[model samples]
Target chain A: MDPLILASEECDIAREVVCVPANVLDLFEFNSVPIFIGLGAVIIALVMYFALRKPKLVPGKFQASVESLISLVSDSIARDVIGPEGVKYVPYLLSLFFFIWVGNLMELVPGINFPFTSRMAIPLTLALLTWVIFVVEGIRKQGLHFFLDLIWPPGVPVALKPLVGLIEFVSTLIVRPFSLTVRLFANLVAGHVMLALLLGSAGFFLLGVLGGDISVLRGSIGAAWFVVGVAIFMFEVLVGFLQAYIFTLLSAVYIESSLHPQH
Target chain B: MIADVLILAEEATESSGIDLLIPTVPELVGGVLAFAVVFFVMWKFAWPQMQQLLDNRQKAIAGQIQEAEAIKAEAQSLLDDYRQQVAGAKSEANQIVEAARSQADTVKADLIAKAQTEAQGIVGKAREDASSEKARAMTEARQEVANLSIDLAEKVVGNSLDRAAQKSLVDNYLASLEGA
Candidate 1:
């Protein structure tokens, strides 16, 4: 069978097991991790709903834990990116943060390992939402001037003005989504591939032609893979949270830039 | 390749479902649909609530921190007040003690001076009395001596006068009486 067929077969297996969103949804072959992602969000919402049935002066352990995480995201992304305005947007950013983080983390769970973010659809959709928020708010606040400000942020030299406008426009509109999709997709794929490769090295080598042994190569592979796997696991964990954060951060910055039209 | 995947998704159904043979990754249509679902669901259900919760939460935490600061300031003020009061009390106590000491010293000195003056007056009056008594005694002694001398003379004359001298003394006495 062709490798594409094999890959398709693997995807089919992934579909059966993973929450692979049907291609009917998009041009990208992303698993409908959002189904799970959204469901997870709803579930988180439900959890928070029940947890916060009555908002208390002294939060319970679970409430405190959830609130702490929300606060952390608020501090890290909302404050850092949006500044004072960021304070208000923390809720949106926090939801984005936790949802993405949980989506990425789900992959670590046994038998449920493929993160939806590996699919371009997940992050792309999220980034697109950010774009919409910024755009809507931008137009609402600055009228048609929001886009103009993107082109020339008022203080630029008249000579360098057109070039800077073009650059800023392309960066904000075109590069924004591309980079968002790429950042999340690439990290997730890389992390998954790394894990798979680490896990399969022994099986692959041992099953090779005329190979009836798990040799020193296999041992080294296992040991090295284990160590690297552990380190990568931690890094990927950070990346999972960080990419979501970056997505939100960039979104906030982009919105601020568009809204303020200043440096 | 992406186009082919789009066709398959379009063809997808509960009965026909996802075909396992196709391998193409859906990029654009999937992007649109996923974007739609995510944005819609989030905006309608999750985002607003989350945003409200977060906003309220942010305000609350900030309020908490601000309240904590206020409590700290109030506590600090109370502490400062108590400290001032203690300091004032100490100074006041010291002032009272100092005033008492100075007042006692003045009183003691006045009493000592008054006592000295009165003692001197008593001594001077006692000396004067002693001198007057001495003068009186001397004068009295002188007069008693004179009287005794006179009395002795009289006795001696009377002794000499006897009977003979009685007529002469009588004459003389008679002369003295006549002359008197």
Candidate 2:
């Protein structure tokens, strides 16, 4: 079988199970997700360290732009969602956004066409971290009774208390992290798969056109798919930013709910 | 053929049901460590500076606004002082004009009075002179008439009379004429 066919078949399996490629380096045998994640983190750290090496009251162009990026997360995501006390969490949220964003942007790079976040490992880990943070915060603030309060909300009727509590337990404790992880992982995987399919089809069709065996109709279809592939590539860029924003926003919301459970 | 190929590919890639959704231990540990390092760097270094920059900007804007307000107040006070000074100067000018006018009036009245007194003195002296001249003329005429009458009598009688007797005779004739 062709390597492309084999890889596509692997994609189906990859979606269901984590497939460790035999050809990968020993260091990345377990999962390359952490290596890419670490690379993203290093890149972000270096950019931040250099960009804000000497923070100025009146910042230059690069510094101003970087400041604006930080402020966007701080003001829009953390502060707006989590309120005044969210100021302390701005750094964490900023790190998460930059890390995920840089990780997602790996798909656009020519040599590296794979996004680190396309894998479930990093997203799951991040989601688990968020889950832990919010749960701990809730427990610290509301005490061990936080679990009870979450499960049995104040407004439920006596008859439906058990049913509602069970639903809340599953949704808040189990489904929240699951959904957070799945949403990020699925979106990135879907985009990566779509891009791969489109590009692969374009390449295949272009070969058919160049081989002079295909009809004009098939050749035009190839050109059309190529154009579509280009368009989806651009769309993926927007998706990348949007996913990062949504992930950070949801994290902030969870943290905020933990801090102030009333809303 | 494509379906067969896909199935074979799926079979080739599939292993012992290790779910993709479940994170492996190494991946989890690496992710946690990496994220921790990044978070620490961000929280310790970048965030504080960004916050400080924002704070500095706020303080700078506030300070500028305060300085502007202070300057405006100072300008207002200076303007007020100038206005007051102008008003005072104007009032002082008016007072000076009024005092000059009053002084001029007093000097004018004094000059008029002095001129009137001088005129009165000149008129009285002129009247006195005229009356005295008239009396002298009258006495001189009377004496001349008496001498002419004596000369006429001497010529007519062809003789001269005694001084005392002539004087008495003249006086007696004049008195008799007056009584008549």
The most accurate candidate by DockQ is: 2
lDDT per residue as tens, model 1, A144-213: 9887877777789999998998998898778887787778777886676555444433233324312534
For model 1 the local lDDT of residue A190 reads 66
TM-score of chain B taken alone, every candidate: 0.61, 0.69
Model 2 alpha-carbon drift over 4 Å, by segment: A1-39, A58-64, A109-114, A155-166, A196-223, A261-263, B1-34, B139-180
Q: In model 2, what is the error at residue B146, expressed in angstroms? A: 4.4
lDDT of 1 by residue, B23-106 (tens): 234533543554444434544554455456666878999999999999999999999999999999999999999999999999
The lowest-lDDT stretch of 10 consecutive residues in candidate 1 chain A is A12-21
lDDT of model 1, residue A187: 81
Docking class of 2: acceptable
Q: Which stretches of candidate 1 lie over 4 Å from their true place?
A: A1-35, A83-88, A202-220, B1-180
Q: What's the count of clashing pairs in each model shown?
A: 16, 0
